[model samples]
Target: MSPSLLAALLYAALTLLLLMTIAALRATLVITRQRTADAFTPAGDDVSPFSGRLCRAHANCCENLPVFGVLVVTAALSGHADITDPTALWVVAARVGQTVTHLGSGRRRAIRLRFLFMLVQIALLTTWAARLLWGAMQ
Candidate 1:
């Protein structure tokens, strides 16, 4: 498979991992009879700090996945995998870095590092999209 496709799959896996973490946390609470299933807030505000960070991390993935997905799909469909293949894994790496940084701490330094990761991803993806579109127009 192309690196771009593999990156997309990895991105999806990362998202799923976050979701599973949230589910497991909630399940633990329910199973331990600490909280009812229906008592949890959607944003995880009522939960512990880690839960809140998990929710935010998952949400960040959800928010950005489609942008990455659509770009990767477009590249494949439009014969522009060449545009994305080189930096695809880098994008995934940045994505993972962003999430890891987000999950690691909520301090200002960590937040800045997370933002840098996110910026790396956005810049790479944007470059890919622009290249693909530009190539298509040729």
Candidate 2:
């Protein structure tokens, strides 16, 4: 029930989420590349996702992981264990939104919602970190 424990849990969850997202993104890239090449064969046809700038889905997830992990650890060390439950929930929500955004049919909407959730989660975590630091300085 301690804040530190909660923070640890959150950190673990965040790490797992980031790893899963990276795996999914890599798989998508591999599949797309294979299909593209196959379609371009002499007797094959063009069949692939639209050709354009690569999606940043996995990159974004990786980028956020460090921030989330650091905040959780900082909060735990600062004795703000009370914020763990909510922080973990927010992290879960953000991960859900991320998955949807990455693979859902309505990508634009999903991405928007995912980003919004991510912002909310980050704000909550930042607040927790600040509180922990403030408490330590007091």
In terms of TM-score, which candidate is strongest? Answer: 1
Give the TM-score (vs. native) of candidate 2: 0.58
The 10-residue segment of model 2 with minimum total lDDT is: 44-53
lDDT per residue as tens, model 2, 28-115? 7567675433233221112223211123443555566676667666666655656554556666567556645554544677668767
Candidate 1 worst ten-residue window by lDDT: 42-51
Q: Give lDDT tens digits, candidate 1, residues 11-119.
A: 9999999999999999999999999999999888689887889999999999999999999999999888888899999999999999999888999999999999999
TM-score for each of the candidates = 0.97, 0.58
Steric clash pairs (candidate 2): 3-81
Deviating ranges (above 4 Å) for candidate 2: 1-55, 105-107
Q: What lDDT does candidate 1 reach at residue 119?
A: 91
lDDT score, candidate 2, position 130: 76
